[model samples]
Target: MKRFQRIAGYLVAAALVGYFLWFASSNLDIRVLHELLTPPVIGTLIVAALAYAAIIPVTGWAWARLLAAQGESWPVSWLTAVLAVTQLAKYLPGNIAQHAGRAGLAMREGMAGKSVAITVLQETVLAVAASLIVGVSMLAASEPGLAQLPDGVRPVLAWVVPILLLSVLFLSTVHLSPARLATSPTRAMRLLGKAGGLPGARIALPALAAYAFNYLLIGSGLWLLARSAELPAALDLPLITAAFALSWLLGFLAPGAPAGLGVREGILIVLLAGVGSDGELLAFVLLARATTMLGDVINFLLGSLWLSLTRRIAR
Candidate 1:
């Protein structure tokens, strides 16, 4: 069953990637891409890549804090290294691979499997909540762009309430007290398993804040890419940021999209439709994808180096 699921996921991912390529080739002017290779634009892309890469350590920090909240003590450096190395797994067919990779690596490093599992669940929930918080707040503040979104897309907003409610329920229920668990032990166990525990407010709140900040960094990278494409000055940064955040959420939620590959770009193009010429918007989307890929590569390299150095020092 798992093997079949994996194959199906790969097929879906391949189709999405193919669609993205087709869209790029059909709508984007090749000349615009070449023109964007100017020294100044290249510099901006580099900066944008770096900005995207910075999210890795912050994510690692948040995860580490979660672990600490649960009475697990692991070095943040090691945790970050694990995240950086596994980061590429997000591009794999199933979005779950990255979390699995993290769990596997942490377990190999002597962390309990149950702790890793629960913390990962907590992290996923918190991350999604953070994305919604940023995306919705920004969208609300920038009503003009919200009004511009296609009518079909507007219904997605209705999902916000249910998703938030579910997230809140998961975070709260997972931390049921021992006495409460004992009363409905079977039901609670089914819901949380043996590994369920919630991080305290101090830990969760800060982690949520950090994840929100990471979204800003992600949006800033896209904004930089848009600027590199010489988009119109009238396009508000908040709108652009909100576009990316919402696109990211959509992508993240999508199944078998491989880091939200085609899905994110498609949504971004729709959201920022009037920001620039079609050619420029296409160029900006392609550049934004490239920027993030480059950032992931940078993070993987830096993380590898960190792990290597730490091992050497310990030896």
Candidate 2:
């Protein structure tokens, strides 16, 4: 049964990836592709890619803070590598493979398994919550009656409210008692299985700040890409930032939607309605995705190099 379930999951992931690739390719033309390959745009794309990669360190810092609360400390370089490499795993059938990879790496680096697990959970919750906080804040600040969310998106927003509340509750409660969390990964798991807790506080504020900054960095990248593409100057930076964050949040909430697949693109386009012609919008979305993939490659290479250097130093 377990094996069958695993196979099913892989099939679903492959299908989702296939669908998104088809959607993008169908909308792309040889001329459009060639146009994007121009030297100037390519340079801008590289810069945008680096901007996306920049979010990783902020992520590592947040995770590091969580681990530190458990009485374990791992180098930021190690955590970043673990995060960057494992990012590709989210494309696999099971969405949790990335989490498993991070847990394995953290344990290898001396963090208890349960500590790793708890931190991962907390990080996921906080990250989403931070995205929501940024998204909703921006939405509210916009001139009243500017635009209403799409009907389809309204349900997704509704569904996320309870999760956001629960995440806040978890964060507030977890730090109340951080003493003697656990000695070993196995012990940590056993303790969690019996009860349910793990730790953080002093760094908690900074961690959240880092997580929020990470979103802003991503949004900034989107803005850069928009500018490079000569997208509407009228769109404004804050609106673009909020739009991407909200679209991303919608994508993250979508189940079986590998990296938010069609869901994200759809939401983004809807949010940016009237910003440009349909052709231009499609081009921007494709460019954004291309730059994002480039960023992933950069992240993988940097993380691999850092990991190799650290290993050599240790040896």
Candidate 3:
């Protein structure tokens, strides 16, 4: 059954990627892209890429805090390095490569496998919750953009309100005091894992905040990309941020889409439909992808360099 599910997931992911490629090829204008790549725009993309790269350490710090909360002590730098390098694995076949890679690498660094697994779960939950919080709130604030969404998406947006409420309730109830780390058998902890208790509210809440901030950084990068393209001033940073966050959530949830590649662009195209001309929108999507890819590469290099330097010092 698991095998069958995996095969179906791969098929769905492939179909989504194929559709995105087809759409881009059909709708994107090469001439517009060439015209859009001005020197100033190129510089702005570099800055945007840097902004995306900055998310890694913040996420790493949050992950490290989760580890600490669970009685695991590891330097934030080490966790950051592990996270930055392994993050590139998301582009691999399964969308889960990064998590798996992170687990393996942390284990190599002497972290317990169970702890890694628990932190991964906690991180995933927190990340999704943060995305929903930002995406829904920002979307609500941008009534014009919300009104622009297609009818199909409007229904989906309507469900987000209740979902967000339920998520908050779920998060509120999952807190475990630090004293109960070893003996807590609460259902949530059992689900998270019995060996290592879930992080307490003090830790989890702050980590959740960090994850939310990461989304803002991500949105800021997209906003910069839009500004570089000379997109309309009326599009506003909040609307673009909301669009990217929502698109990011969709892509993140989509099985097998490498780092939410096709799914994100497709959703962005739809969400930002009238903000710019179709060609301009297409150009922006492609640029956003390039900017993120560049950021990932930069982060991987920085992480690798950090590891190498630390190893040399140890020797």
Top candidate on TM-score is 3
Selected candidate, larger lDDT, 1 vs 3: 3
**What lDDT tens digits, residue by residue, belong to model 3 across residues 228-258?**
7887764667787777887877666557777
* Structural similarity to truth (TM-score) of each candidate: 0.83, 0.77, 0.87
Compare the candidates by lDDT and give the number of the best one. Answer: 3
In terms of TM-score, how similar is model 2 to the real structure? Answer: 0.77
lDDT of each: 0.76, 0.70, 0.80
Clashes of 3: 0
Error of 3 at 235 (Å): 3.3
Residue range with the least summed lDDT across 10 consecutive positions in model 1:
172-181
Model 3, position 75, has a per-residue lDDT of 88
